[model samples]
Target chain A: MKTRVETVAIIGLGLIGGSLAKALKDNGFCREVIGYGHREPSLRRGLELGVIDSFTLDLDAALSAADIVVICTPTLVAAEILVDILARTEALEQPPVITDGASVKGNLERAARSACKEFPPYLVLGHPIAGSERSGVEAARSDLYVNHRVILTPVAENSSEALALVSDMWAAAGATVVQMTVARHDAVLAATSHLPHVLAYALVDALAESDESDEIFRCAAGGFRDFTRIASSDPVMWRDIAIANKAALLQAIDQFNEHLQQLRRAVVEEDAAGMHETFTRAKQARDEFAAILAEREQAKTS
Target chain B: MKTRVETVAIIGLGLIGGSLAKALKDNGFCREVIGYGHREPSLRRGLELGVIDSFTLDLDAALSAADIVVICTPTLVAAEILVDILARTEALEQPPVITDGASVKGNLERAARSACKEFPPYLVLGHPIAGSERSGVEAARSDLYVNHRVILTPVAENSSEALALVSDMWAAAGATVVQMTVARHDAVLAATSHLPHVLAYALVDALAESDESDEIFRCAAGGFRDFTRIASSDPVMWRDIAIANKAALLQAIDQFNEHLQQLRRAVVEEDAAGMHETFTRAKQARDEFAAILAEREQAKTS
Candidate 1:
């Protein structure tokens, strides 16, 4: 089998970046894995951990030798870096296919379009739906993307060859590639990812500032712990996500607020039947989601 | 060491009830374990599973044979059952010391006081801060309460001896007992447990009814699964809990709404600093809560 990507460049050297480099190296998906980051220590650590064969601080040098580039910086920083990379790679005889691991797509796409006049057809927007509460190169793993969904939102300007290269790269990293429009991707992610993160942070912040904070947390058991687990996620990263996907996230917040208000009314009015109806519906939906995920895992293993 | 109680009766052979029976039987907290339930099948299953040495549908018979009775029914049902038990035990020569595993404490305490002219000093209200998303006797485990917190809210009418007996029983079941007022327990639980359940149910319910329901749920990953795991919990049980602790739960919902609103505004206004601060505070608080729980677990093992 001919490899779709010969040499890959990963920017950021964080969890996603380092993990992708390691997965590519372990799977023999590419001939060389080059890591680039503003942090000298993280770049060195990525080399020490065998996440990359070489390290570079210069974006032009990294882009010059790469067949594909995976941007893994935080959302805001990723947008800025993508613009810089597009400008640097424009002069290359064969500019490497570009993609990113950003959680939000709409803002990044707009920023990319505005940064370059031609808005390179090789730029394929992507997000790998896998991460942990922990961050940085130390938390990266070779199997992080295995069996996980990596959504690709390819624009009209994207060439089919570029899309195939980026998709194949993610497949090589052990992720299942799914394609959708940018709007649909942002809306669905807002509901599933961004909304839940906001709710977790808000719930924990509310409880933390309460008068009985000590007792409240002391008595919090498994359910509370799991429910708020995402509250312990990287704050700056989430802050950027919340800002980047502002419109869709705001709409999600409104919808959730409406549902919560209905529940609050039910509780205040002591409407047991209404409360039961809502809770039962939620359980059914949640159970169906779990069943689907289980089936997917079974399919992957079997 | 001598067993604190020679005979124990568990009413409503559901998750908590069956688990308590198993724990008591395993720890030898009592010589005889009696199970009572309105459902004959669960009662029979309790005995067949060795969760109970005997089974009965007769409340009076079970109460008479018990040295201590642990009521583990839905909040509303538990309140009604407690009243019925208090009424029946009034004429007894020596009534069994009473405790309950109801999630909310205030309403149950009020109902107990109102049920009889002289509220029984033997009644000690408690809630074991342990459970699973699954329910019924089939999900019961002997180690369910191991290293878990059991909050006991003893009113002025509760005798110290009765409190000690109930506390010791839970201790024997591998739980650490903590004391608080009924108001405090209800308030703290509203902030920690009930509010989180409501948010989870509401979030799932909203997404389930959306046009992109399938896509939204299909892409939901580990965070969504864990965050909504409690949404799969028994609906009727949570409904009763929400209604039982209406005032405190409503207040919690309101507080959470305010915090959520703050976050929503930050996103809408593109206030990165405000969102970062909120997420950072939540991360710090959640991490501290996790650290405290880990410390408690370590102390138990060490």
Candidate 2:
């Protein structure tokens, strides 16, 4: 099974990149796993942690040695690095199947399409819906993507073989792979991931800057901590995501704001029935989501 | 220490009430624990579970027998119940030191004041910063308040002995007690707990009402689960809380909306630097809060 890909290169050496390298090695998805990052220290740490078999400074050399390339950098940086990789790989006798682990897909797809004269058929866009508040190579783990959702937004021009390889790589990492258009991927992720991130950050920032900040935080309990847990995520990466998925994110924020306004009105008017209705619906929906997640976990174990 | 109170009466027999009864009995805070509720089944469940030594629907008899009373009903119902208890105990030879576990303090305090020409000095207002999504006597636990914060908001009229008795009871339940004015408690809680609940409910409601709800929830991961965990909380309880803490909640919501608008503007303009700053501050703040909570937990066990 590992012979399908002799070597795999993961760019960025961050949590996702390092985790992917370790998962690939642990699952025997590839014969060797190499890591590349903008920072030499992170690459060194990845090597020290045994997340990768080797580290590469040169993108061209890394691409040349690998059967597949996984871009795991921030969304903005990923776009530029991906474009550069496409350009460098264009002259290769056999270009490797390329994929990314960015949170947003639409902007990356457009950027990739425009960067090359003819969009590469081997470029498969993907975003694994898995991460923790902790970042960098030190926090990477082999089981980070186990039973997580990995969404691939492949363009019409992408080769079936390339898509299959990308899908198989993630599957080997213990992720469940699903495919959709770039638009659909961005929209769904905006609603599920990006919007929640925005809300958490905004809530924390608002409270932190308030007059009663100290007391507010002191009284905050388990629910408050869990609600704002994502606010501790990597800021620069989130910033990039917010910008790259601007349209979908903005739409999500607007919808959320409108719903909040309705709730606020009910609170102000002392409309108990209205508030109860909204909260009941939300509770039912959240419970349903929890049930589905539990079923998925059970299915995976079974 | 157990002789401080001969018999403790818990009103509501729900999660908080049942848990308090169990904790009180487990810690020898009282000779016996008695439960009262509007519903006979819940009171029966409390007695059957041994959270209470006896069950009663007759509040007058329960009040007459108990040395201390803990009100553990919903926010709205708590206000009315506290007032009724005060009125019923007004002519008694010895009134029980009364305290409540309602989330909001201001409304309850006002109701207690208005229900009697002169509020009883034995009445103490409190909010325990502990709960689970689960409800009712079946979900009650003896350790629910262990190492948790319990905020006490005593008015000028509250007797020092009454305050001490209330504080000692919570301490016996393993809670750390803090004192604050009703206004401060309400403001702090609105910023911390109530606003987060509103946001979670609104976010879930928005997504649930959307056409892409199923797909959105399908891809939702750990962050989403934690973010919306409070949305599954009791709808009627939360609705009552929203109305009870309307002013402060509305103010918190407004501030959050302003912060979110700034974030929205940054996203719309692709202001990477602005977004990064806001996200960085939020991350730092959230991390600090988490560290404080960890320290508190460590302190408790040590």
Best by TM-score: 1
Model 2 misplaced stretches (Cα beyond 4 Å): A1-3, A44-50, A138-140, B1-3
| Lowest lDDT block of 10, candidate 1 chain A | A1-10
lDDT for each of the candidates?
0.91, 0.90
Query: After superposition, which runs of candidate 1 have C-alpha atoms over 4 Å from their true positions?
Result: A1-3, A91-93, A300-302, B1-3, B299-302
Docking class of 2: high
Q: What is the DockQ for all candidates, taken in turn? A: 0.88, 0.86
What TM value does model 1 have? 0.95
Per residue, candidate 1 scores C-alpha lDDT tens digits across B216-253 of 98888989999999999889889999999999898888
